[model samples]
Target: MTLSEKILARASGRDQVRPGEIVTCKVDLAMMHDSGGPRRVAPYLERLGAKIWDPSKVVIASDHFVPPPDVDSAEILALTRRFAREHEIESFYDMQGICHVVLQEHAHVLPGMFAVGGDSHSPSGGAVGAFMVGIGATEMAGVLVTGEIWVRVPESWLIEWHGQLGEGLAAKDIMLFLCAKLGMSNDYKVMQYAGSAVTALSMMERLVLCNMSAELGAKTGIIAPDAWTLAALREGGHEVGDDALRWQSDAGARYERHLEFDAGALAPQVAAPHSPANSAPVAEHGGVRIDQAYIGACTGAKLSDLHMAASVLKGRKVAKGVRLLIAPASTLTTREAAADGTLATLVEAGAIMLPSGCGACAGYGAGVLADGDVCIASTARNFKGRMGSPGALVYLASPYTVAASAVRGTIGDPRDLLAMKAAA
Candidate 1:
C-alpha cells in the first residue's frame, strides 16, 4: 500500500487495506478548544454516564477566548480548567495561542497518526504527515469514550500545480483561487495537491493550503510525506519513524478527478463579497475597497508572513480610514518576532498588535465588523457573517496584498507596490 493507503489502513484498523474499503480505527490523539470542548465534553459526560476512557491522549486548550473577552467566556474557561483537572488530561494548553498552532508547537502531534478535533482546522496536523480529521461534538464524544473513529476512504482528487507563482503570490492566494474556481457548494469532495508547485512550498505553506480545505468542504486535505515534511516534524519535536515516513501515488494511481493548475499564469486572487469561493483577479476587480485590513490568523501568522507584512508597512502608515490587526500564531512566534523587531515594524506602521490567539478571525472576541463594513483579511473562511454582522463584507487575499491594501485603504495589489518600491 502507498503511504496514503497505509495511513488510511492504520486509521481504519485494517491489517491490509485496499482503496475504497470502509473501516474503523482507534484514535491516537483527540483535541478540543474552549468554545467547543466544554460543550462537547459536557454532553459526553452526560451521554457516557462515566469518566473519559483515557485522559492522557486527550488535549484541550482555551485559545479561542484567551484573555476571555467577556464574563461568559471567563466562565467557560473556568469550566474547561475544572474538567481538565478532574479528567487528569496530560496535555492542556491555556488560552495562550491558536489551538492548531499550539498543537504542533507544544502538543507534538505526529504523522501516520490519526488525530481528530472538534474544530474544522484540526487537519492542520496533516502537515506533519498525520491523517487528521475534523468532526462535530457528538463524534468527539464517541472518541473520548472509545478512542476510536469510523471513516470511509474518500475518493481522491489530484490537483497538480506547476510553475512558479509570480511576485506577491502566496499560498493563501492559491486557496482563494481554487475556492472560487471550484465553487464552494460543490467542493466538498476530497482534494490533494501535488506537482512541482506542491514540492516547492515550505511546510507552513503546505499547512496553509491544507488548512483551508475545510472552506471548500473537503473531508480533510493531505500531502504525501516528503523530506521537507520530515524536517518540519523534527523541528516540532516529533520523531519520524522509518515506516511512518511514506508517500502515496504508485504508477497509474487512480484518482476520482485530476485538475491542473498553472501557478505562473495565476494572478493573486481575492475571494470577494461574503463567500470565499466568489473570487476575482485582484486587478480585474479594480478594488473592492476595505475599511479594515488584517494580516494575521492560523493561515498567515507564521514568521515569514510577519516578515512580508512588516516589509510592506516598513516606511508607510496604514492608509486613512483603514485599520489593520496583526496577531502572532503562538507565544514562541510572538517572542521571535519581537526580538527580530518585526513586531516593532508592524506597530510603527500603525497596525494594532493583538494577543497571540484566534481573536477577531473567529469572531469570538474583538475586530468584529459593523453592518456594511468591508474588510480584507488573511484568515481562513470568508463565509457570510464569519467575522461579524452578515451585512458586513469580507475579501480574502494574501498577506502581502493585505498589507498593501492597508497602506492604501483600498483593494490594492501587492505586485504594484513591489514594483513602485523597487523603482523608488
Candidate 2:
C-alpha cells in the first residue's frame, strides 16, 4: 500500500489491514488560517497547557482575512498573530497567498505525508502525493493538541485519462468533467489519477484538479508523484536529494471503482448554473447569458492562467452588460503579473483590478453578487450564497472561458475568442 493508502486505512480505524482492508491514519501536518486558527488553537492550548508538541509540524497562514478586511477579520488576525508568536512556530506563511497555494508555492508539503487544514481545499497537497484532508474547527483543535488526527481511509477510485489536452482546456476542466461524470453522490470517495494525461499536466495544474475535488465530495484526489512534481518542488525551494519521484499503483492495486476519460475528445468544459458537477462541453452552454465574469482565484490565479486571460482579452473590452473582476491569487502573483505587464493588459481590456486573497470566493467582502445576478467564476465552489445572495447564479469555468465570457457577456469558449482576436 502507498502512503495515502496506509493513512486512509489507519484513519478509518480498521484493524489487521491487508491489501483491501480499511483503517485510520494519523495526520502528519496540520494547517489553519487566521479565521479559524485562533479558535482551533485556543482549545488545544487550553487542554495542553499552551505548549504545542511540535511547532514545525503545525502551520498557520493569515490568509482567510488578513490585514483586516473588517473589524471581525482584524480581530481574527490579531489573535492568530498572538498564537503564532506564543508557539514560536517556524513554518508559518504569513501575509502570503491563499493557504493552499502558499503551501504548494513554499514547498511545505511533501510526498508520502499526511496533512489536514481548516480549509476545504487542504487536499490541494494531495497533488504532490500526500494524503491531505480538511476538517472543521473543533477537529483542527484536537489536532493541534494531540498533533494527530484520524480519518476514514476511503476505498480508492482509479481515474485514467490519456492524450494531450487541447487548447483552452485546463486541469480544472478535467475535474469538472469528472465530477459531472461521477455524479455528486460520489463525494467522500478517494480519487486517484493515473495514465498519460496525468503525467502530462504540470504540478500547478494538477493541484487545481485535486483541490477542487472537494466539490465532487471526494475525500481527496491525488496523482502519483513524478518528475514534473519533483521539478515543481525544486522550483518551490525543496531539495529532494534524488529519491525516486515515482508513485505508481501496486501491480494489482485494488480500487473499489474506476473511471476513464479520453483527453483527446474532451473540450473546454463548463459547469452550469449552481453546481460544479453539472458540467457540459463549453459549446453546449456557451450562449447562456452572464452578468459577471471572474478570472482569478486560488484555483485559477496562476501566471499561465493570467497569460491565457490576457491573450483572450487583449485589445478587447468587457461586454456592456458584463462586469469582469480580475484578482491575482496572491500578492506575489499580483506582483508577478505587474512585472510581466499582464496586469496592464487585463486592465486595458476593461477588467477591474482587486487586491489578492480569497476575494469573492470567500463570499463576505468583495465582489458579492445580488439576487438574480449571473456570474461565471474560477472559484472553487458555486454553492448557494457562496458569494452573496443565494439567488445569484455562479457558473464555474476555467480562466480561459471566464475571459471569453467577459468579452461576450455570455458563456463563451476561449478558443472562439482567440480565433476572433487573431482575425481582428
Candidate 3:
C-alpha cells in the first residue's frame, strides 16, 4: 500500500486496505474555523445531545472573518467561543490567523494522524505526513459527535520531481505547473509528492505545496516522513519518536498513476483569472498591468514567503497606481517576520500590513479589488469573484513574482528584477 493507504489502514484498525475501499477511521484531530464552527455547533448539539466526543482533539480558531465584518459574523464567532468555553476545549484560538498555521505551530496535527477540518484547505497538515482531509459542515458535525469519519481510500498518484528549482521559482510555481499539466481532475485520488526536489523543500514550502491540493480537486496531498519532517516536528514542539517515522510506503506499494517533472527547467508560473489551472509562464504575460498585489493566506503567508517578498521589495517602492497588501499566516509568523525586519521592509516599500488572518484572500477584511481592476496575488485560488467584484481579474503567482509585479504595476517575473539587482 501507499503511504496514504498505510496511514488510513492503521487508523481504521486494519492490517491492509486497497484503493476504492470504504473505511471508517478514527479521527485524531478535528478542526473548525469561525466560518464553519457556528453552523456545525447547532447541528452537532442537536444530533449528539451536546456531548462532544473529545474536547482535546477539537481545534477551533477564528480565521475566515478575524475582526468580524458585521454583527452576523461577530455572532458566529461568539457562538463558536461559547461552544469552546462550554466544552472546555483548550485548543481554542481566537483571531490567531489561519487554522492550519495554528495547528502546525502548536503541533496539534502530527505524522501518522488522521485529521479533518471544515475548510477545503485542510490538507495543509499533510506537510507533516498527516492524512488531513476537508469535509463539509454536515460531515464535520458527524465527526465532532462520533470522532470518526468514513472515507473511500483514494488511489494514489505519484508526482516525482527531480533536479533543483531555478532562481525566482517556488513551490507555488511547481504546483501551478502541475495543475496545468494534470488538468485538476483528482476526484478520487491523492497526490503523493516525492523525489529529491520535494525532499529538499522546507516545512513551509511543503505546506504551500500540500495546501493547494484543494485546487487540484484532490482528497489530499502527502509527503512521507523523513529526517527533515522529524526535525520540523521537533522544532514545532512535537515529541516525535521512531514509531512516528515508520509510516512509509511498502517497497511494492502500488500507484494508480505516476508523473515526473524536471524542477530545474521550471520557470515562475502564473495562473490566469477564473481558474488555477489556467496557467502560463510568468514571462509570457509580462506588462499586463495590475492594480493590486497581495501576499497572504494559508498557501502563501508563511514566514519564508514573507522573506521572499521582502527580499524583492527591500529599498523599493510599490508603483504609484498599485496597492500592495501583506498578511502573515499566523501571529507566530507575524512576530517572527517583525523581529526579522521582513515586515518593516515591506512597509517601507509602501505595503499595507493587515492582521494575521485570511485578509483579502477570502474577500473579507481588506484589499478587495474593484471592477475592471487586475490583481497579482500569492493566494491559492483565483476563481471569479474570489477577492471581490466579479468584474475584477485575479492572477495567482508566488510571493516573489507578486512583489516584483507590485513594484512594476504589472505582471512581471522576479528573475528579471533579481538579475538587475545582482548586476547593479
Candidate 4:
C-alpha cells in the first residue's frame, strides 16, 4: 500500500485497506478557523447535545478575517471564541495566524496521523506525512461528536521529481508547472511525491508542494517521512521515535498512475488569470504591468518565501505605481521575520507589511484591487474575482517572481534580477 493508504488503514484499525473502500477512522486532529467554525458550532451542539468528544484534539484558529473587516465578521469571531471557551478547547488560537501554519508551528500534526480540517487546503499538514484531508461543515460536526469520520480511500499517483532545481525557481513554480501539464483531473486520488528532488526540499517547501494539491483536484498530497522530515519534526519540538520513520510506502506498493520530472531544466512558472492550470514560463509574460504584488497566504507566506522575496527586493524599491504587500503566514513567522530584519528590509524597499493572516488573499483585510487592475501575487488560487473586483486580474507566481515583478513594475523574471544583482 501507499504511505497514505497505510496511515489510513492503521487509523481505521485495519491491517490493510484498498482504494475505493469506505472506512471510519479515529481522527488524530480536527481543526476549524473563523470562516467555518462559527457555522459548525451550532451544528456540533445540535448533533452532540453539549460536550465535544475531545477538546485536546480540536484546534480553532481565528484566521480568514483576523481583525474582522466588519461588524459581521467580528460577530462571527466572537461566536467562535465563545464556542471554544464553552467547550474548553485548549488549542484555540485567536488571531495567531492561518490555521494550517498555526497547526504546523504548534507541532500538533505528526506522521502516521489522520487529521482533518474545515478548509480545502487542510491537506497542507501532509508535508509531515500525516494523512490529512478536508471535510465539509457537516462532516466536521460529525467528527466533533464522535471523533471519527468516514472517508473513501483514494488511489495514489506517484510523482517522482529528480535533479536540482534551477536558481530563482521554487516549489511553487514546480507545482504550477505540474498543474499546467496535468490539468487537474485527479479526483479521489492522492499525489504522492518522491525521488531525490522532493527529498531535497525544505519542510516549508514541501508544505508548499502539498498545499497546492487542492488546485489539482486531488484528495491530498503527501510525502514519506524521512531523515529530513524527522529533523524538521524535531526542530518543531516534536519528539520522534524510531517507529515514526517507519511510515513509508511499501517496496511493491501499487499506484494508479506514475509521472516523472527533472527539476533542473524547469523555469519559474506563472498561472494566468482565472485558472491555476493556465500557466507559462515567467519570460513568456514579461513586460505585463501589475498594480499590486502580494505575498501572503498559507501557501506563500512562510519565512523561506519571505527570505526569497527579500533577496530580490534587498536594495531596490517597488515600482512607482506598484504596491507591494507582505503578509506573513503566522505571528510566529511575523516575529521571526521582524527579529531577522526581513520585515525591515522589505519595508525599506517600500513594501507594506500587514498583520499575519490570510490578508488580501481572501479579499477581506487588505490590498483589494480595483476593476481593471492587474496583480502579481504569490498567494494560491487565481480564480475569477478571488481578490475583489471581478474585472481585476490576478497572476500567481513564486515569491521570487513576484518580488522581481514588484521591483520592475511588470511580470519580470527573478533570474534577471539575480543577474543584475550579481553584476552589481
In model 2, which regions exceed 4 Å deviation? 6-24, 47-50, 244-246, 421-424
- TM-score of model 3 vs. true structure: 0.98
lDDT of 2 by residue, 31-72 (tens): 888777775668666876746667788888877674566787
Off by over 4 Å in 3: none
Task: Write out the backbone clash pairs for model 4.
Answer: none
Model 3 agreement with the true structure over 135-187: per-residue lDDT tens digits? 88878878878899898999998899999898778899989998888777778
The CA-based lDDT of model 2 is what?
0.79
For all predicted structures, in order, the TM-scores are 0.94, 0.93, 0.98, 0.98
Could you list the CA RMSD of all candidates, in the order they appear? 1.9, 2.4, 1.2, 1.2
lDDT digits (tens) for residues 72-152 of candidate 4: 888888888888888898889999999988888877888899999999999899999998998888788888888999989
Error of 4 at 125 (Å): 0.6
Each candidate: what lDDT? Answer: 0.79, 0.79, 0.89, 0.90
Q: Which prediction has more favorable TM-score, 1 or 3? A: 3
- lDDT top scorer: 4
TM-score winner between 2 and 3, please give it: 3
